[model samples]
Target: MIPIALAPASPPERSAWRRHRFLLLRRSSQLAVLALFLLGPWAGLWWVKGNLASSLSFGVLPLTDPFVLAQSLAAQHWAEATALIGAALVLAFYGLLVGRAYCGWVCPVNAVTDAAGWLRRRFKLNAGSAPPRGLRYALLAAVLLAAAITGLPVWESVNPVTLTQRALIFGGSVAWAAVVAVFLFDLAVAPRGWCGHVCPMGAAYSLIGSKPLLRVSAAHRSRCNDCGDCYAVCPEPQILVAPLKGKAGSGPLIQARECSACGRCVDVCSTEVFQFTHRFDHRRD
Candidate 1:
């Protein structure tokens, strides 16, 4: 007599778009930012100009990187009123909303590192040797110090972020090798290593958005099954520890500045435990 085989039960997704809802939105936003920059040289529709460091929108709205401004000041470099205003605008925007979300949502280099991370996980690779998170701050300090010592904004010359964006718009250059090195480092050296613990830009933005209005809260921890899926997906997994495990006194919010607000935890959880909320929402039930 042949025995009947029972199929394995597959867990169902909670939303219409399934687990990929936020991921899709994030990818589209990243690509769209790149497109706006490229549209000028590529299609002759110059909606945005000058890249993320400093950009003018339709030749009016100016956006600049506050960190770059800081480095310039450290280097004893003079800044015009427009640059000051532009940096303030960019700082205010990041402060009020996304924080280091730029690292996850807008950075052009994110595409390569993310692909490396995905491939790393697919191969079930080990964490390998990675530097401590404090290295990011060290790198940040070093960049400023280099600027001061050299009397120049040194990092801007070879920053992989700008290199990647420029390479995207223009044809590839020697910077392609740098971009490829980052991909290989993230893939083989360590997973999520670059953005999570290495990029000074991400570290600076994390500080800028240290008290951002927008945040991810483990609001419904009661529904969590201790499945560890969120931990696996989070770029800064350490941030989730306190919020998810904290009792009534610990607050339900993940307040770590390093939390990129990338929403991968929100995307991957089968139980729908995480949600975006204001910083004050401490619904620890």
Candidate 2:
């Protein structure tokens, strides 16, 4: 077991940029996407309009949240052709990449939860028991069920991801409070409670991108020092067990649907035990 004291440390031999390259790239991706949304409202640039729920890019490209589309369909709300196109685009994008990549690279709430995680490690705070991982799938089902029964897309009203994006681009509301609540919950109550165990949208994405080309491989598992830094930083550490420990006939590819493909494992491993690769790359050392 990696002591909590050593959990946050990355491979020190690598240059600082090498150690944190993927992390920095993810942050840049998240912030850059957010800035595009903010440009129209804050600076009147009008590059991307609407919110993450649905948006028009350059008034030509359409992008919609497929989960929201599902909810709308469940509610018997007829969607426009553009909405359909948008949803298809999103589905196709995530179909090629890992689904929860949205959580790691695009969701604004990710920034909030990530900050909470960093603080937890910095303070060595013990995370209490988290809710079952299966709970999110139930919540996903319930969200659709509520949409069907109540004739409303109920989750959207309270979804932290959309709320955070809306609040950041459009000024202020309960988004800050909602985002803060998620941060606090992850920090004090559960280590990775929200995105890892409770977000319905994440559940929806996991299903959509259940099989993706992109994956993190434990190709060099033989070099692992058992320092636990990869487990310490992974958003879905449970997926690492089989690949990292290397059971007979088990491939090095992390094939789990829940993996966010966040690359924190790759970033923190002292021995370069993990790397981003296609799902087919199972070569083990």
Candidate 3:
């Protein structure tokens, strides 16, 4: 009879592969943030110059962002009003699907904040308690009011995206330096402090995130031993910690509007206590 040989176990090799894949997702997000900060606005400008002004003005521009292109378009095309309407729908769709995950994951400003949080941790600085959850909403209201009253995009003055673009393209300015400094300082003090407290886009997302849809939820709750590993790994730990503690009971809950849906919490959960789920699905123990 021919000798039968079993293949040696490769569990360790498979585990290493999985680890590498996870790291790649994390690192790629960081790199993408840096690229967006440097390239996003210029890309918008290019679209305008290439006769795709509608795409830039309506389809991609954030509502809080300056409508420079929109105003220019108005001057150029008096009857072409559909583009703005189309853009609004797109923005609404984004808000519905994943809330401000775009801001946390894709916005260059958030990337800067992430870097700042790293530097803060390196120095062992304390950022203190997180700001009130309602602050972003207040800021959004103020921005909209200012824009309406002044007939100009007031967000341009404070938008990190615009500031970063101008800093890079125009060889730096005091505003750019100041914003960068705050981002770095916040990083030294608080992890994701900026997104959690101050982003208007985040405020917009939070308003609609509770709608029925697929979202991150706590799974395998009985497996949890309250070790807090998930909290430590979470960018927005406060958002998930209370619920995880069983204080909020077993149900879907979002800890904050700034939750980026990055899956870091899921990755870090030692007992696999978190999973993504739709609104109608029953919570599994």
Q: Arrange candidates, best TM-score first.
A: 2, 1, 3
CA-lDDT, candidates in order: 0.86, 0.89, 0.57
Error of 3 at 59 (Å): 11
Name the weakest run of 10 consecutive residues (lDDT summed) in model 2. 3-12
TM-score of each: 0.93, 0.94, 0.70
Candidate 2 lDDT by residue in tens digits, 1-285: 776554645545988887899989999999999999889878999999988899999989999999999999999999999999999999999987665688788888888888988998999999687899999999999999999999999999999988888777665758778888898999999998999999999999999999988988999998888999988888888999999897776789999999888889988887899998998887989
Best model per lDDT: 2
lDDT of 1 by residue, 1-285 (tens): 899898854456577676888889889999999899989999989889888898899888988898899899999988988899999988888887777788878888887887987887788888666689999999999999999999998988888898888777775766787799889888888778889889999999999988888889999887788889888778788889888888566777888999888888988888778999999888755
Q: Backbone clash tally for model 3?
A: 4
Relative to the true structure, candidate 3 reaches a TM of 0.70
TM-score for candidate 2, residues paired by index: 0.94
Better of 1 and 2 by lDDT: 2
After TM-score superposition, the amount by which residue 174's alpha carbon in candidate 1 deviates from its true location, in angstroms, is: 1.6
**Model 3 poorest 10 in a row by lDDT:** 45-54
Query: Model 3, range 23-111, lDDT digits (tens) per residue?
Result: 35755775654444445455742422111112343245532221333333333533234555654654565556765555545555655
